[model samples]
Target: DAGITQSPRHKVTETGTPVTLRCHQTENHRYMYWYRQDPGHGLRLIHYSYGVKDTDKGEVSDGYSVSRSKTEDFLLTLESATSSQTSVYFCAITWDRGTGELFFGEGSRLTVL
Candidate 1:
């Protein structure tokens, strides 16, 4: 099984504050992604990295940024948190893009007051 971990599984912050969530993986997978789940909007991709120092923005990438300094770790940061950004974030990994299977971390819940 793929080994995935996320830091600060639960977080609460005031509006306009900055927040960062970290995701670490031991699987050495080539592709890692960050997503947020919410009602009605479903799951939306925030960012993803294909290799070390290689990253790309996704659909809802406006307030989110990602960094992949190494193959085993990916970080997602919210430059300035907002109420609308409150949601459960997830980290996922996949070795084969065509496989349609992704290994996901437990989740990180963020609340902006």
Candidate 2:
């Protein structure tokens, strides 16, 4: 977890509320990714944005959306929070995929009742 910071380190919410997690990186890595860590899934990609205003959905994209208006900022929003979505989320940034070095932010832990 270097050069990246995620806000709201911990959160507790109801079943239908909206949730947004912010990731800020100082390294200016063009490739930014959002991932969630679960009990058995390890780390799964939720969404990733490679450049400003350009994004792509990942395997577990349902009920999730992302926006990247600036190089240093990435936002992940859950349209409607659900209990199944409760997990620790991480934001990763890498200078290049070839580098094979990705830096992640301190995870954001979310719990939905």
Mind giving the per-residue lDDT tens digits that candidate 2 earns over 16-94? 9999999998877889999999998999999999899999999899999999999999999998999999999999987
Model 1 scores what on Cα lDDT? 0.92
Ten residues in a row with the worst lDDT in model 1?
A: 94-103
User: What are the clash counts of all predictions, listed in order?
Assistant: 0, 0
lDDT per model vs. reference: 0.92, 0.92
Off by over 4 Å in 2: none
lDDT of 2 at 71: 93
Off by over 4 Å in 1: none
